[model samples]
Target: MSKPRSLDKSTKEDVSFIDRQPDQLTNQSVGQAEPEVPTGSDCAIAQQSSTQNINALPVDVLPPRLQEIINEANICLGFPKDYLAGAMLTAMAAVIGNTHTAEIMPGWKEYAILFTALVGSPGTNKSHPLSFAMQPLIDFDAEQAAIFNEAMKRYEAAMELPPKDRAAKGYDTNPIEPKRVRFTMQDVTPEAVHRILSENRRGLVLVSDELAGWFKNFNRYNNGSESEFWMSVFNHKAAMSDRKSSQSGVFIRNPFLCVIGTIQPKVLTELAAGNRNANGFMERILYVFPSVQSKVRWNRERKSPSFDIAAAWREILSRLIGIVPAVDSCGEIIPEDVPFSPEALDRLFSWQNEVTDRCNAEGSDTLTSIASKLEIYAVRFSLLLALADRACGDEKKLIDADIVERAIRLTEYFRVTAAKVQGIVSEDALTELQLAVLSELPGTFTTAEGVAIAAKCGMSERSFKRFIKDRKGVLFVHSAHGNYTKL
Candidate 1:
């Protein structure tokens, strides 16, 4: 018999995300100057440069304290600030989910846990920043594990006693199962994850250094049940774990799983071709693909991050982890509700209407669905930013317009990045012959030229036309007279 393969194993070379990516982002410095935002009828020019603005990190978009953390990771250590931002924010949101949840608008409550994907090639320092950011959660889990070990020891010792002696032991004879204090899990099955969430009703995070296995083996153990569970978690819907073989099946009233991970460009392309994701999986995720952040000037005198930074992250989390959950009649702990201010409510409506307008104008179901999910993410982000602005302390504050605007900026950044990711994946999906035609064609070409070029590649002009017709959105949407322009 053949040896079984490790389907979920990550790259053994320790390269973060991928082996390499050649399409480096524009090398812009942090202090690079930007043109002024026009306020009047000259806005058409502004629209054209919107992608550029979003691609560039508005360094000040973060609260001053959080920005300090970003600077240490990115500017000082040469990590991609975008990657650091997503990972750290998601971790912060996970801690918030343990007790506090934000209700952006009335009847629109959302957990702080967010599903963020840091998209970069190998050696982009994706995991370095994430490792630092997730330390608090790791420590929290360790503490809980130690506590559980001791509890189990006492329980085991009590069992060694005689029946009458065990009866006299009282509570020590029966140990309560350890609370699910582990907030982060790497590769795990659906049932295992369900069990974890059942214990830790607050939430748990799925962290993968290499996302190939997670995406590829999504439903390996349970048909489509695993995928369905993830979808439910993303929407904060009710979830249950029903297993035929196990009597310890768990049912959770609230299931929260925040996913943070990195993947190479090649893996992303493979999944894209599989088209295995539907019902807005790709749309639901926030992708961060900042270009080429490996260019750092090292000085022997430059100091690495010190204990203060670590202490700061720990201190913030220390307060957040102490969140006391409110319990219901059944003694189930309920998450506290975080809400937006009145002005924030007014602005949310305006933003929602604007997004709706844009989605309708796009005239594409895929794009529309992405916009719809982004709307929820925008609210989630506002909650995160609002928390960060207050130093992530226990004292909660209602999200305001300013916080929403900042989150919208980050959301817009993801929008631009997603388009780039899609562009690369779609172009990669093209056949060798199609890619050859594209390479041979000029930036702008006529239909006759396109057809002639297609014929050169062993394709009939009619077949070429049929193939290129639907590809307008993916490849090059034409102008008139078959005048196609490569984006």
Candidate 2:
């Protein structure tokens, strides 16, 4: 097939051609020539050009203070440099004043993967960056500070309350005022989540630790009721209820709530098989897998060292709160000659395809439901790098393939782990595994007998049930008797 047409360089910067058909363009050398500098006779044009470049900088080359924040956050989370950098830039750009009209501000409502998973082994300081490095952004002003305080109080109250009380109340005994809270699986409840989303319209970062624990308990507590609750919170429409008034009313819309969850790969298998909530939830998250295999030891002494720059960076980010990027009305496509390479494009598409395939195979429609979410995250990450580039003083609002590649790589690591947990056996192995188990059973067996047969086949009762359901009308047959038979 011919190569896709090069993005139209002549089009204004505000256009987006990402969804258009790829037309074959004439093969030209990569990297278009920079536009000619305007002269004094074109004073108006020169002024505009000068303004665009005034604060522009390459995202890769950040200021010392910003770089310090990046390094600190990375260290706290033990995240790969690229992953932490991308997330920080995205968050920064969302808060910073955007110079490009084509870029969308980073917000929880626009992306499906509002929750991000930060996976790493212990000592990675998973909670440090969020609690400390980004503390400034999270605790920017009185409003934010108050919100944080309230959240802690509510969490404390929930912990102190009896489980019976919590279940009966349909709300936390300690109601966390939305602004002061940071949510995680530890404190995540349908009611708490609903309150947070409804009240915090601007957005907030939710950091969860040992996510496996949350998923493990999700089903046991309520007979899989909490699992459904999570599903609703993750994708449910946000609504406001004013029941106190004589004429109660409410409005429904998307609420801005971003989540960051951490988990280990070893825990994934158990979480996935036993907990219905954990099985497919990863697809709803933007996965940012930290490097668990790194041999480079962290500096123990620096673990708790206070960085002076952290305070300064917080102040800078605070000033940019509520500033959103202007959307491009011109419908300009990101130029093809920009830095993203063919290899990078392939990686992104592959990751998307892999996630899509796994979700399809499992018959889980939520996978398809959140495709726009993954795209939004990838685009937002690129925009963050673009904004950082501008902050470092680059004139171009363009995002190259490298940014896309990095985001995809991080997303891929997360997505693959999630897919594995779904226990979706490859088609090649499915028949063999099914036949092997069936062949061991008597020609005719009751549903309870089939369960016994599964035990003999070394399949857990849970896995056996799921396997039967997954292969219905395909490899195995299900009957009204609740027993499964081989075709």
Candidate 3:
């Protein structure tokens, strides 16, 4: 394995920065994180201590099995909600999302498409939760690969036959083109995604353990189409890619793409300053940054849970998979539109009107977009909940008032968390600039090394020190000597 980089000679220790996960949203789900278990009394005490900021949605926000998955992951890997909740959201998106399973209201059809970002520093055990949650999907893809390869062999054999023999064998040009069987695409190009979308009428997902790179290269093609495509797909609008170079291209009348991943807080600080996400990218996401664990509890004698969390995950997903995605006579996926129950419709429209009036009163773009979409997300969340509850044997899929109530609560939780993300990322340009400098430095950097890198940004040594000094317990945790680490 390669050694971690250092800043200078004689500084033997490492200096770390950007502890939070970066802007990776699309993908399959599974993750683990450390948990700060607080009793009701402890919570009360904490609240009495100050106006406590609960940075995460409570564990109960997730479904029972999903909650169990997150809990077991925490016990095993110490992943926090910052990681696991996003993974659970991803798990929901992947299982129920691609299928035209159910919908929300009239003329407003939507799948369970959700984008989640786990915001935390590295070493907090962020990636594992997502890995654990997405393991089932990953396994399913691997299983499908064998099927795809067999089809490819048949397709190639058919292509190579003589014209008469091929006609007799019912072979056509480009026959049996390998179906778009894969689901997860990580840090890939737009054309590659277009190809996947073309073949997989069900849709595709984008997932990354580390999201910083994805956001950095998001606009790499320099074409505005990527941005436009992302915006359009958020609403399940029909889209197609017209690639040159003798490609037949791909089209999907109903495109459902879900994004989820982790991002470093420092990278996000720099990234939030850019205008890339202003065009509905960030607006569509349910951003979350659960506060770090207040204490690390280690029981040397504690035995690891023997239960198979992945198996349990697969069992739930297997049921969802049994509910086949709708397909057309042309073998394309036909989405099943779900209407709101009388009670659900009443509650949803009440929420819509309330939010519309509130946003109009507030006159905030962010709030307006958030309020509008959160209600829509509520619908999606309700459908997912109703479907899961039914498929798992509780009852048949029914969008009811109870589901709507829970959906609203979940959306409320995400709204608070997203505000926390936007507040930090959008504010403090100097801090963002400083974060950029730290990101460039080796994890452990000497004062001279830091000065040299900061100077490239037109920052003088004194100015840099002044900047770091002011950011004491806020953005940084000062280390010994001239070294520092991101908090």
The best candidate in terms of TM-score: 1
Query: lDDT winner among the candidates?
Result: 1
What are the per-residue Cα lDDT tens digits for candidate 1 across 299-364? 555568744677877776676666678878975667666677887777667767766765564344
lDDT per residue (tens digit) for residues 165-218 in model 2: 975656565564344423221356544555554544444454555666556666
lDDT order, best first, reads 1, 3, 2
Model 3, global lDDT:
0.61
TM-score of each: 0.81, 0.48, 0.73
Local distance difference test scores for all models: 0.65, 0.44, 0.61
**TM-score between model 2 and native:** 0.48
lDDT of 3 by residue, 201-234 (tens): 6656788777776666656664556766876888
